[model samples]
Target: MTDAMTLDSYLAAGGVLTNPTNVPPRYRAELMKLMATFVDSELAGAAGFADVINQGPGIKERIAAAKIVLEKTDHADRVLKIMGEFGADTDRYATHHPWTARLDRKADIGATRSEHDMRLAVFNYPISGWTDAVVMNLLMSRAVAEQLAEFSTVSYQPLAEAFRQIAPIEAHHGELALEGAVKLVENGASQDMQDAVDYWWPRVAVSFGRDDPNRFEHLRSLGLRHSTNAALRERWARSADEALKQLGLKSPS
Candidate 1:
């Protein structure tokens, strides 16, 4: 009921910040880190998927894959513009890394970031083929949807609004992936698709991040995060599991 509140109190009370000028130093740093991770992940994911577009089983599948690649790059550009407001050299930042470069598919670098960028670790692994790529797309898209939903409630209004606009597009990508997956299953690739699911499930889950209460406490205090990583991961797992079940695929152990 208080008409006037401190920045901390305002944010804690679900208030929003509309611009970069007034953010606190630590909040700005944290926000930049968060945005960087998103931008880098989208860029890396798009780049990785670009090569696999040709591997899609049919014209429609190829089109879906291609569309996902385009939109993910666009999503990165959208968030990178916000990072630019924080004085980032967006031009250099986008091309600074070899976004197309990825580690071996069997690399065991769990939740670790590459030296060159802040993309989630799941993206560092290479995609094997059409089924593998589609499975990765389906699982990771759901993870992205969950993360974007959490981010849409971020205290930064501009970024929150951007995420809100983006959530459905990202959700649509998941729908496309789901549809492709169903077709793959129908085409007698169910076992191969299940194998791909098993490979990507754990990696995608790790993208939700560690269940660090201390870190979540700091982020939550700033209203940068509205939910715990564990909670978000659980939500994603439940949804992803049901989706997989409907497709006659088993959830990864």
Candidate 2:
């Protein structure tokens, strides 16, 4: 069998590629794109959240926000290091894009990425205020948890190991958001929290993007993706809805 066929067969049999040298050209391209998207999103997310750290309502909140910012930057660094093994210029890549740049709150970009970065479209919209920032964090962190769960099983062993280590930290970020939301609700910010939820629900929902069966099938065959976008989106929606309900809020109507 050809090298590509042998690689495909091995991946199909649940084999893992441990290093860049073992990655085929096509797999390398897709893997690089995946890693770029993740690193870009994390960097953009950290930059945006950093702006709101001072807006947090209390010292604890600020600390939590700061922790998130620091850890997310670390996560990006981890993935970018893996990309560097593929000859990516890690230094230039991190600074090449204006990670903090965002569109107007009213911009309707859907799931499309911005021209200069691969961040999810949800991050492109500005966080409105303290309440809005908390709400956005709660929602988006859940989405991140779902995506990380899927990626933790990727065919690239090193990347998968990085994700495995990062998953719990990301999940803890979600827990912090939940604590913040509960506190906000108890402080009579229910209406404000709900408004933020309504505003962010659809935007965060679209970050899962649309399902493309053909593309999904191809990625699945390569051990790059294990679930359809729609399935992951639904999982996120269910978890998000439950989180809102716990806060005595509802998903956008």
Candidate 3:
């Protein structure tokens, strides 16, 4: 056994290892793939706000509303750092991986995301914030939080640290997002909340991850995934349902 501990070794130890060094090839690949996806996904997501705050009809409240997107992108960067420490090839992840922002730009109807301006977009796609998109993401992020909270217990020191850092901030995100939900009800999405809920319900149920058997072994053996995708997804559905009720919303009949 090498005296130095790498990202893989640390995680694979199941709390038995602690140190940061070189990452194993396969584990590195997985982490890099995961992080790259995350980085791109978040940046893509952030671009949505710029679309809203910049070109759309302006709202005074937008100044603060815009901040959420910025914080989310910053979150992407923080996570990227965790990815980088694991020997992620930033050049590759940056250049090759498609960011979520690009996904927002897709012409496909299902691919289309929500915008702040309701007129230019669908109101209840469960994606456009100006319409009814914000609630869905808020629900999904909250769901992911449950998994991340457990990830904080990863045997890897830095990975554990990363989750710890992100988890606390999520509390505020949940609050602000719920606040957005409240604003959404008052502003317009009140009637559409049901639509948002209905559309988001099935999607969240299936968005967990691949069902491959071997996938869990790698992560669990490595102590990286303390929570399964199914577990988190189930939690998400419950929270989303509860939150919808609290906001005086319901899934479409």
lDDT of 3 by residue, 1-253 (tens): 6543554455566653343354556655655555554455556555555555542234634654577677767877787777766655655544453333222322334323334211112212224545444565566567657756766776556666766887777667677667767877777667777666665655555546545568877777766666677777667667777887888876444
Error of 2 at 182 (Å): 1.0
* C-alpha-based local distance difference test score of model 1: 0.90
**lDDT of the candidates, in the order given:** 0.90, 0.92, 0.58
Q: Write candidate 2's Cα lDDT for 1-253 as tens digits.
A: 9988887888877788998877889899999989999999999999999999999988999999999999999999999999999999997987899999999888998899999988889889988888999999999999998999999999999999999999999999999999999999999999999989988999999998998889888788789999888888999999999999999999987
CA RMSD for every model? 2.3, 0.9, 6.3
Number of the top TM-score candidate: 2
Better of 1 and 3 by TM-score: 1
Q: Which is better, 1 or 2, measured by lDDT?
A: 2
What local lDDT does model 1 show for residue 94?
Answer: 75
Q: What's the CA error at residue 247 for candidate 3, in Å?
A: 1.8
Q: Ten residues in a row with the worst lDDT in model 3?
A: 117-126
What's the CA error at residue 26 for candidate 1, in Å? 0.5
Lowest summed lDDT window (length 10), candidate 1: 1-10
> Which sequence of candidate numbers ranks them by lDDT, best first?
2, 1, 3
Better of 2 and 3 by TM-score: 2
